[model samples]
Target: MMEMFDFRTNNSNGSVKRRLLWVEMESVFGDLPPSGISGSSHNSFTVEKSAITPQECENAVSLTHVGRAGEAQMVDVSPKESTKRIAIASCNVILGKKVFDLVLANQMAKGDVLSVAKIAGISGAKHTSTLIPLCHNITLSHVRVDLHLNPKNYSVDIEGEAASTGKTGVEMEAMTAVTIAGLTVYDMCKAASKDIQITNVRLESKTGGKSGQWSREE
Candidate 1:
């Protein structure tokens, strides 16, 4: 059977606005009755006008990565102006007590852990597009990776910064750098202790995008 329901709400000036909605319910194996509305009727369905502001509408339309059907696609940045872009990412590598002591004393069998990790990080940033499917192949102007030891936690903190002049931001590159650097640390210290852990890989800050600069809160 078909049912009509009335939905009522107050308008801005306190006047009541009523909308009629049609719903159909089914019974067990019975011949369906026709809806009074014609098969080709255009007024059978009602579409309410959006209440979004002009600025909100503009922002919604500016998201170009996907289509109206919500498919995944790369955003076209060809029309975007090229600008200097910088991003910083950070991660931590926790080591066992024996491995931590060895790292501080530079006695690891795998040689200097921090230096090798730094080089690996820069290489990772340079090849970010090759690693991540959707990332753009940006020519980075500068890449830096630093590692610091925290004796109390037996952890090494890794940070990576990437800079480029391009249509897209370098945030992906920075994140890739930090991730690879952490992996490198794990590889170099695994012989000393198999319990090494890599954690908290994240983008700490990014600058030079349409959205402007962003940083994580403490």
Candidate 2:
């Protein structure tokens, strides 16, 4: 299906009047050329709409991280635009009643449990690229880890948020932060309880880049 999108061509000659045009995704591969694309002054065309679903778009480019010879490869983002990106992830540590009370009272033997976990989570976020081979090492503007005691479930809910201005999103960093923080909680409280469980380590929301914003519904 064709879609209407804002488009403009900017060149050394000057900028064309911004206008809305109907174009198809196939136009990207030169299958059909829309009007006003043939002149020498037409250096570039930026289209802001597409006719395919996100999953289809991703599936179309699924092989981008693999070479023709089938070896694993890193995606090149040098040509992509840099934008502010942020992501939040969360995990729950089910520590039972005894351990939850102990943590709530800050009585863990390994010093302040939440404080240490926060620091570990921040550190983990900064080193996410190292932990995951395909992740890009982007400069982070901020990283925060928060843990709350949930009396209803007798669990500790840990959330990690990361922000950066770069070509890639911080989703992986946020998820890694929560995972490391959850593991640290287990390490600090294992002597008190053996059945600690880390559950629902997942990305909650992500914003910026070409795909825009996404959030998980409650």
Candidate 3:
């Protein structure tokens, strides 16, 4: 708490008047604020807010990816148990109607667009660690990529599922798989429509890990 100082001065009638002033405890006492009632309030008071308590400071939290020195650091999962982990991610490749029709008929110049994209998704899942510097390399036990042609939106919906038994989760791998798959579809249809877009890339569901199960619906 701040210290209250009383400065004395003489009035015109020779009466003594005092004014209370708010200042830092260290400035006047040259020490930390004492743990006791120092004085009473004045007619006009200048309140000084105290610093946070030790308990409050101890309860503060920081980001998991940040180190004690506030630098970026990879999470250490060495102490975690190896469990069956599965993650699913999805994205949409919005190809214009003209390009969508070509892809639906398997007539893209880049060969079968859906087939090539599926392959790319699985490959991307395997190399997720290389693509993302902070991601851990997981020995994925299974990887599946599925592509569906959405007639209403003229978009190819891609979903990738990754499964592994490792310390860290496979969500990043699943996301990378869908992202690469969507990009592959965009590449195949770019000749027909340069405006093709990859959108809504996100994790759909996950199982295992210390948190158990989670889904987009949750």
Candidate 4:
């Protein structure tokens, strides 16, 4: 049985807003629960409501990336103070048995697979702003790409980390590194298996900037 959950924010009355965190349930016990199961027994799934201050509500209404009249524009960070910003992202490439063995044995037709991918990831991180419009061009201080082979899952996990001292966060740079690294793996291994799949690209963690630190819970 599988389930899906959707979370969204609902703002009403301009003073307070509620964040709806909904979880869809699949019944394991036939169409319905047997015997004494009643509506009152499922109180644990209730969604809670919270109060939002006026300032916070106003801030939420203003979209930073969109200017007046729904015009898209780059965010102005000139007034923001420069601070140490770091971000990490990850993705996985699922490979077939032949490709997996080839990667594990470092016998891919394209020379060293991981080494070239690492260098490409670093280069991609350094040039993220040029690749994606509206992104601030930041001077990165450090960039690292790590690739780990998961024999149990027949996949390779790529992780990218980027750091910079700038007004904007390096989340885009880290994400770009992970994306290019995954693509490089596919490009190198395509001759062995065209069925290779790259997936689960996402930001794992970020630190510094006005938001401080944030990490995805496992």
Best by lDDT: 2
The TM-score of candidate 4 is 0.72
Superior candidate under lDDT, 3 versus 4: 3
Model 4: per-residue lDDT, tens digit, 1-218? 22222222233532221222221122222243332556644323343343665578767857788865456899999999999999999999999788999998999999788898999999999999999998999899999999988988899899999999999999999999989999999999998989999999999999998889999974
Tens-place lDDT digits, model 3, residues 62-133: 477876645679999999999999999999988978998998888898899999999999999999999998
Which residue pairs clash within candidate 2?
none
**Which residue runs does candidate 2 get wrong by more than 4 Å?**
1-63
Choose 2 or 3, whichever is better by lDDT.
2
Which of the predicted structures, 1 or 2, would earn the higher TM-score when compared with the native?
A: 2
Off by over 4 Å in 1: 1-65
Distance from true location, Cα of 56 in model 3, Å: 8.4
Write the residue-wise lDDT of candidate 2 on 63-160 in tens digits: 76676545689999999999999999999999999999999998988878888888999999999999999889999999999998899999989999
lDDT of each: 0.82, 0.85, 0.83, 0.82
Q: TM-score of each candidate?
A: 0.70, 0.71, 0.73, 0.72
TM-score quality measure for candidate 1: 0.70
Candidate 4 achieves a global lDDT of 0.82
